[model samples]
Target: MRLPIPTLALIASILSVVTAKSSTGDRVLVVLESGIEKGDYSKFWKSLEARGYSLTFKSPKDDTAELIKYGERKYDHLIMYAPGQKTFSPALSPQSILHAQLDGLNTLYLLSPSLSPLNRDTFREYDLEFTDSSAGNTLISPFSSLASDPSSPLIFPAHSPLLSSSPANPVLSPSTLSGGPIVFPEAISHFAGETPYGFPILGAPRGSYVGGSGGNSNSTAGEGRKGGEVVLAGKMAGVVSAFQTRDNVRIGFVGSGKALSDKVWEASVEDQEGVTHRTANAAFAQDLTSWVFQETGVLRVECATHWSKTGGEVEKAEYRKNEEVAYSVSITQYSPSSGTYIPLVTPPSDLQLEFTMLDPFVRTPLILNSTASSAQGSTTYSASFRAPDRHGVFKFVVEYWRPGYTYLRSSTTTAVVPLRHDEHKRFITGAYPFYGATVSVSVAFVLFCGMWLGMGEERGRKKAE
Candidate 1:
């Protein structure tokens, strides 16, 4: 008997609630400025929805815009598009949003030149410092022929020295190099501090600088201008960047909200050669969100185990010193298109496993074991080596960190106990010389005793005579 239509619809809804499109989760809360409508970012929103994300839009000051309820996060991701808004509802305060991120919410901040002080400070916490938006410090590229004025929004060539994409990074597709130039309309550039957890997705053009229309970045502005400083210039500026927390939560920073808007999505851009082409913002934005929302470059450790190769024991908590040991871990990466985790067919060449005790005693590469990876949706990595001769507590650690991928970490502790006295071998083949020497000494003693006894008996017969 087939289920009714209503029943089917209910089942679908239930499944949607339980299953997440992004590896992190699917619920997204987009906090828009008061005057801004969700329609302003319709294309961006629609793309996310197409990937099965449920978006909830609210004004910055809306009292109902609560990110957390009863100490539980109601959403898995957040989009803060209120660049000009200075005040937010209590529930959506900067502290609260940060708290939500700490609770595992991925956040995307779309900023404007008139960035609010609150937002600037919040971004500073991530080691990002934006140009003074109030001073009209928009990034300008002199090489772009598209803009009539020197200070007009800059257009950058899609690839290389002009605008570099982190293709090695999963945040942008490899096809981005062949795509059209990206347009930065009224863009606000920023300086990113050195951080291991952060990386730039799109770098500023080579000639771009934060200054007025006619000023040379290297020279001081004329008379009375004692301190005319160029905040950032050249590749020092960041157009877009991302940060990943230790927990694998992601946060993205876009210099201009308009970059992802429908206007830019449907617009065209011109390169330095005056060749006009469609904008690459749509594809770039999609790839950016795909990473920031954990749709791609997401990794999961399916299983990890260690065992004694000599004893044929699996996952034993203890092992004898100098024992031949084996370790294996299975991992998978999420595929947004299929909404499932698939095996990372080509394992990272640098992936390593460390058997450490305070310091690593054995550091070896985790070679892909195709035969052991017969299970679906995971790739198994294995390594075999002898345990350290010294007996002590040690941990098997796997730390895999790349720019765009989720940081994978797995640690298992085990003890290496000394062999028991009874566990020692009774005889050894390598001591043949000592064994022969003992036999020779025993024969010599027996012969000496027989001669002494014979001599004593002969003396006794003489005394009787």
Candidate 2:
């Protein structure tokens, strides 16, 4: 029997809602200066809605509203969009925001400098610092012929491969959208961060610093700055900065609020030749949102297990050195483009696995196992190796790190031991020659003992005679 058309349509609508709810569970908290539709940031909110996010709004002054409560996160992501405000609601204190991030909330922060503004103590904890004084620098590049001026450092080669690239460099676009390099006219210049926490992911071009109160960073290590980053050091500053918390939660810094505004994000300008193109801002916004919200670059270790090949024991936590062990794990990546978690990534991103102790005893590349399912959204990679002759505790570890993806790490340990004395067989087929030689020596010794006893008895009889 076929279903009626009306009934089918109703079913489809319900299914669609269910799918959206399940694909991405990103509950977003957008703290702004005012109401959503009442503000000039309607377009920014629209871009997020397009990505299937459920959003809640809180004004900078709405301290009574809780961003989180009762040790349970009310939201999965947070966007601090009110840059010009002098202060925020009590709920948005540095401690509260940091705790939310620790609870796995990815946050995007937009900052601007003004005298006597609210202190950004939250950013400082993440190592993002801003001086009280303003900058005389422009984030422009002098080398690019496309630079309409010396200040817009976001200029890329007109024919640069990034323009037509897919996935938009994570800050550029989701995989489903096309993206080019991003540029903003009014970027706030700041000093760079150091290793791990302070690594600069984006930069201004060379020959581009106009020092003022926040003068040329004494950090001019490379690209004209001292004690600063080598590759990230450009003329005056780094435009967009990002870092991942130990929980794999991401945090990104956008230099200006105007850069995310509707006009700038979608603006297309004409050059001297009348060639027109849109700013990469729109795609950048989408991509950055996806990344910070855990919609993109997410990795999960669904399964990790090992078993002895000879014993066929997956449950055994101990094994003998002679046994060959099979190690495998099921890993999946959250695809923001498709809005679902999948095992394999397009263009074949690599996943690395290590078998180790103090050092890697068996280091080998993992091959994608036969067990992969598109429906289930998981990929299995596996390897087999003989247990080392040395006896001790050993572990299987997998660490997968990519520029745009969340870091993935997991481990499982097992004990390897030598065979007990009683476990050894009395005789062995492989040592037949040694066994036979031992038997022959023992028989000869018995015969020799019997002959010596007879000789002793005969000597005693002769003495009595």
What tens-digit string does per-residue lDDT give for candidate 1 at 131-166?
A: 883235677666652445434344433543213323
**Candidate 2 residue 189 C-alpha distance from true site, Å:** 3.1
Q: In model 2, which runs have C-alpha deviations exceeding 4 angstroms? A: 1-24, 34-38, 113-121, 131-153, 157-181, 197-201, 210-236, 271-275, 337-339, 347-350, 356-361, 370-377, 425-434, 442-465
- Global fold similarity of model 2 (TM-score): 0.75
Local accuracy of candidate 2 as per-residue lDDT tens digits, 282-319? 76676667666776667778888888888765656987
Clashes of each: 0, 11
| TM-score against native, each model | 0.86, 0.75
- At residue 68, candidate 1 shows an lDDT of 87
Q: What C-alpha lDDT does candidate 1 achieve relative to the native structure?
A: 0.79
Off by over 4 Å in 1: 1-20, 35-37, 133-135, 149-167, 214-227, 428-432, 447-465
> Model 2 scores what on Cα lDDT?
0.63
Q: Model 1: clashing residue pairs?
A: none
